[model samples]
Target: MKPSILTISACGIFTTGIAFAGEQHLTCPARLEPDAIQPNHLPAGWELHMLRPVYLTEGGMLHGPPEESAFLVPDNSTSRKAGKQTREMQHWSFDVPHGYTMWVYCGYGGGGATLKLFQQVTESATECTLSSQSTNGRTKEVLEFSCK
Candidate 1:
């Protein structure tokens, strides 16, 4: 038997149950627009790619204890050319609930030394703050953002 679909509203739809002739409706939460949820204090020159939510498992192995939550914002900025190769620097913003420390890594393309950048934690109730640092001729770098 073919099931009949009924329009409930913009949020969901109703349909006849497959097992029986009973009416069933599926409801979903309203979706929020990107601008409506994005932070107002994003850096001046950086562009927001997307918002990422992170969940850590118990007993953090690589770094810290598990059961930690953090939000990551991956962004793309202007390209910088070092020597003959033009490379894109990696930019990341991290938001953690509690006070925590993180590290950023930068490396050159051709067997060059790697540079480590650190983040300065700024305490705020609504948002996290990330410190801006120059690549200093490095081709790519990872920036750590700590939010308290």
Candidate 2:
């Protein structure tokens, strides 16, 4: 099958559904800057993927009530703004093929932050969600992607 290309605008619009074959590309919003992240580091044949957003609430401070839970669609202006405070919090989804490794580069504050890549045991049409494990106290950051 021919490769599929998917692009997401800074305004949070997706051009097309993800395609599993060939090379797939993902475009970051204009608001985001390029940092240390490089897509060339990813394994071969890996393509950029996007997924729906799911939000969960955690219990507030000691003896505090549970925080409100929210679901994000990742397809509008509001959801993008919510991630402004912490770029990592902004949820990005990707469909990574099994046995393939993808590289994600992220920055926080003045110093650089580390991202831990986790593999989801369950696979659904190669759809997987991508987010920062932590923003490292940085209000602004950049994300770059490259797939093999």
Candidate 3:
């Protein structure tokens, strides 16, 4: 079943942070539009090929990465007080294309996500032959899950 989160109207990776202690926030995917993006906003690390759209994992709205970010630092002071920004994101955004959306997330550090979504390769009318795929795992499973 799709998440009730589908009711949302915008999508993006938004976060809040702390300076030196453990933290938490009320987080959810927001809904948005394609034109909300600027031409230069979709950088390589954020997109597949230049024209490919990245889909958000919730209602699957395509959105850019957060404009602002949050980080953690040592509560006890030192020059370490300035704190380093964390690029090791637990959450990320994928901008959509033509209003089509697909969203994904990993359980932790990308452990649960699979390969990129792709259309199957097909034979060329005048040239191609056959293609074969050999692998250890033949089937991958996606299931409905939630965390409290």
Candidate 4:
């Protein structure tokens, strides 16, 4: 039997990937369009590649190595300090076309308890690098990759 996909939309912002109902090949949006009004926004012709999950264990641990596409670096500082949980900050560094500034951010779920708005951050393109901070294990944060 083929697995079913459960897509959750948020005010038409972005669509969630296929849910892991049983056993299925999950895939999310590959790229994100550049927006001018958006901070840390990339210029035209740049698309952010979304990272694919390697394996989400029952313990809420995201295990995977860095990929050519995009990957998150491991950061469990806060988790270590608080003695609660260990959350890793994802860092991605990939090659760009030729000339374009790279931008990184932790978007879509960080802030007030009631209002969960997306947040973004800018990074210098030393060699086309992007990154995301620790997550709350909710899978709402997005780690983008691209150059502007």
Q: Say which candidate scores most in lDDT.
A: 1
In model 2, which range of ten residues has the least summed lDDT? 57-66
**Model 3 per-residue lDDT tens digits across residues 1-148:** 2322322112533322211122111222222244333444556668523233233231111122212111112123211111332111222222234533222221111233221211111111111111111122221122121211
Cα shift from native, residue 111, model 1 (Å)? 4.2
RMSD (CA, Å), candidate 1 to true, equals 19.8
- The 0-to-1 C-alpha lDDT of every candidate, in the order given, reads 0.29, 0.28, 0.23, 0.28
Q: What TM-score would every model get versus the actual structure?
A: 0.23, 0.21, 0.18, 0.23
Backbone Cα, N, C clashes tallied per candidate: 3, 10, 13, 8
Ranking of all candidate structures by their lDDT, best first: 1, 2, 4, 3
Tens digits of per-residue lDDT, candidate 2, 1-76, equal 3322333344332233233453333323213223222354457888544233212111000111112212224321
- Measured with C-alpha atoms, the lDDT of residue 142 in candidate 2 is 32
Superposed by TM-score, candidate 1 places the C-alpha of residue 58 at a distance from the truth, in angstroms, of: 31
3 or 4, greater by lDDT = 4
Residues 1-148, candidate 4: write the lDDT tens digits.
Answer: 2212323233323322222332122222222333311324557888554343222111111122112213234333122222433443333343444543232222232242221212121222322222222234544332333222
In model 1, the worst 10-residue window by lDDT is 55-64
Candidate 3 Cα outliers beyond 4 Å, as residue runs: 1-15, 18-21, 41-148
Ranking by TM-score: 4, 1, 2, 3
Candidate 4: segments with Cα more than 4 A from true spot: 1-83, 110-124, 127-148
Rate residue 135 of model 2 by lDDT.
Answer: 41
lDDT of 2 at 55: 20
lDDT for 108 (candidate 3): 12
